[model samples]
Target: MTIFDKFDQLAAARQALEENCGDFFNMVVDDIISATEAVVNGRRMILAGSNNYLGLSFDSDCIEAACEATRQAGTGTTGSRMANGTFSGHVALEKELAQFFKRRHAIVFSTGYIANLAMLSTLVGPDEIILLDADCHASIYDGCRLGKAEIIRFRHNDINDLEKRLKRLAKRNTNILVVVEGLYSMLGDRAPLSDIAAVKRKYGAYLLVDEAHSLGVLGENGRGLAEEAGVEDEADFIVGTFSKSLGAIGGFCVSNHQQLDLVRYASRPYVFTASSSPGVIASTRKALSILHTRPELRRRLWDNANMLYQKLQDLGFSLGPEPSPIVAVRQQDKEEALAIWNALVQHGVYVNLVLPPATPDGGALLRCSMSAGHTAEQIEHIGQAFAAAHRTDQAAQTG
Candidate 1:
C-alpha cells in the first residue's frame, strides 16, 4: 500500500534490534575532543571506529585554512559546480590533486560516494560492461546501477575469479570496466592490483581503483595501494576521498586519460550536486600538502594498527586477514557481537558495531580503524578493553 513496502525486511530487522538494544544504530558522541577520543554518555572514550587515519581533522594548519576560507567565501556553495558554485579553491585543489597523482585530469565531487557515482556511471556507455569486486562498497554498486550497464561481480579479492569472468567476455567488443578498492573498508584487505591489472590488460579492460580507505595510509608518498603495489601505471583511473586521509569531506577522480574531462559534462552527480564548500576545499588542499610532506604520520598510523592487530590476535580474537589500518574482530553471532560492542563502550572504548548484511560475511563485526593521533598508551588501553569486553561477553553467555 506504500512506496516503502520494499523495506519490510529492513523494518522488521531494525525493530528486532531496537527491542534488544534500544536503538543501537543511533549512538551519539556528545563531544569529540580529538581524532582519537570522544565523550559519550558523560564518559570519555577512545575512538577506534572513526576513519581519521592520519588524524588530520584537528591539525592546526588545516583548521586555520578552513577558517580563513570560510571568512572570505562565507558558508555553503548555493549552486552546483556547473552553475555558480565553482570557486578558485575548488579549481586549485583539482589541479593540485591531478599533479599529486600525476594524472592529466582530476574532478572533485561533493563526496567520495559521488566520486564513484560520477566516474563509474558517466565513464561507461550502454554498450559497456562493469566487472566489479563482489565486496565493493555500496557506492560502486549504485553507480553501476545508475549507468544501467551489465554488471558482473567477481569474488572478493579473487584474481582468478576476475580472470575467469574476463576470459568469458574475451570476444565481446564492448568496453569493460573493472573496479576494485585499494583497501576494503570492512576487512582492510587490499586487492591484488598487479595481478588484477594483468588480467585487465589481457582483456583490454579499463581498471579503476577506489582508494578511499587506503589514501594517506599506504605508499611512500601516501598515494595508496597503487603506489605501494607498484601498479600506478597499470590502473587506468583512481578514485579517492578527502574525508579519509585528508580529514575533510569531498571526493575526486584522477586519470591520465584526456577524455576524463568529458565526464564533467556527462555526469549527473557532478552537474547536479552543489560543489564542496570553500572551507572544505581549502582545508583539503592544506591536508593534502600535509599528507605529502609528513610521511611520518603514515608510519605512526601503521605502528598503531600493527600493535592493535597483533594484540587482538594474541587474545584469540578472530580478525580480518592481513594487517592494515582497519582491524575487524569477528563475532559468532549478532547477540554476542552486540554484547561485546556494548561492553567495549561501557569500558570507555568506542568501535563500530557492524551487523548482518552490512557486514561482509553475513556475520557481526567489531570494526576498528586506527589513527596516527592514537598514542601507544591509548592503543594498549584499547587492547586491554577488548580483552575485558571479550571476557565479559563470554561470561554472560556461559552464565
Candidate 2:
C-alpha cells in the first residue's frame, strides 16, 4: 500500500468535524471578549468551555503586566532556558511555585504537558516502574512512553484496584512511580487521595499527583486535591499546570525530596525547549497571588458548578459522578451526542465533545466546564440549551 493509506482515519475524522463545524456556537474566541454574553455572528453566546476557571485571562492586572513585560523583555524569550532563555522572571516564578507548594525544590517548564514529559521521562530509567491512573491525561501516558519504565494502569478512582497493583510492584521493584490526577478532566470527578495515599504508604511507592485541574480550585488556599485530602506533605511529588486556574502557560513539579532539581539537567524537553516568555511568568505571578489571598474565587467556581449540575440533572439529563468544575451529560448514543453538541452550539453554547475512544470506557459525553466568573443565570441557560438539544435529538430519532 502507498504511504497515503495511513491518512484514512485522519481524513475521515476531519471531514466529519468540518461538516458539523458551522453549526457550533462555541469555538476559539478570536476577539477580546469579557463576560458570558458576547457577540458571535452577532448572537450573544454563553461561554462555558473556557479553561479560565478564575476568569483571569481578562483581568486588567494580568493584561497590563503582560504588556509591560512585552515592552521590557520583548515578545519572545529568543532562546531556550538551558542557555540564554533563563531570565530573572523565570527564577522568580520558580521561587513562587516552590513557596506555594511549600516544597524546597521546584522546576518550571514551557508547558504543563512538557513538564510531565521532561521530568517523568528524565527521572525514570530502565530500572524503574511507573503505575498510573487509567484516566490520567495523555501527558502522563506520553511521559511514561518516553522513559524506560514499565507502565501499569489501575482502575479509575478505585483505591482497591490501585492497592492491588502497588502490592504487586512492591514484590518486585523497590522503586516505583505512582501517578494519579487531582481531578479527572473528562468526567469531572476526583480521585480518592486519602485512600491512594494509604496505598502508597503500604507499598512504599513514590506518589505523584497531577493537580492540573484542581489547583487553585480545591483546598483551603487552593493548594489542590492532595491538600484537600490532607496528603500534601505525604506525596512524594506534585505536578501541575498554569493553564487552567492559574491563567497562564507553563507547568511545575514540586517535591520536598530536592532531587527534582537533578531532572533539570537530564530532561530532554526542558533542555531543548524555549523558556516561557516574560509575560507568562509575570501574569502567572499575579494569578498565584490572587489564588492564595482570595478564597472567594473557589467558592464562586463551585457555586457555578453546583448550579449548572443540578439544573442539568433536574432537566432529566444524567450527569457525571459528582458536582465538579466539569459537567458531562450522558448521551444515549454517538449521533445524539453530536446532534446535542451541534444544537448547543447553534444556541450559542460551547462545550467539549467526547465520544468512544476519546472518552473513558468507550462512553460518550458532552463535557462542560465552569469558571468563577460565570453567573447563576448563565449556568441555567446552559442547562436549558442542553435540554432543548436533548429534545431535538429525541424528536429526530422518533421520527
- lDDT per model vs. reference: 0.92, 0.85
Over 222-319, each residue of candidate 1 has an lDDT whose tens digit, in order, gives: 99999999999889999999998899999999999999889999999999999999999999999999988899999999999999999999999999
Clashes of each: 0, 1
lDDT of 2 by residue, 207-260 (tens): 999999999988988999998999997788899999999888999999999778
Q: What is the C-alpha RMSD of each candidate to the true structure, in Å?
A: 1.1, 1.8
Please report the candidate that would top lDDT against the real structure. 1
Model 2: how far residue 192 lies from native, Å = 0.3
For model 1, the run of ten residues with the poorest summed lDDT = 18-27
TM-score of each: 0.98, 0.96
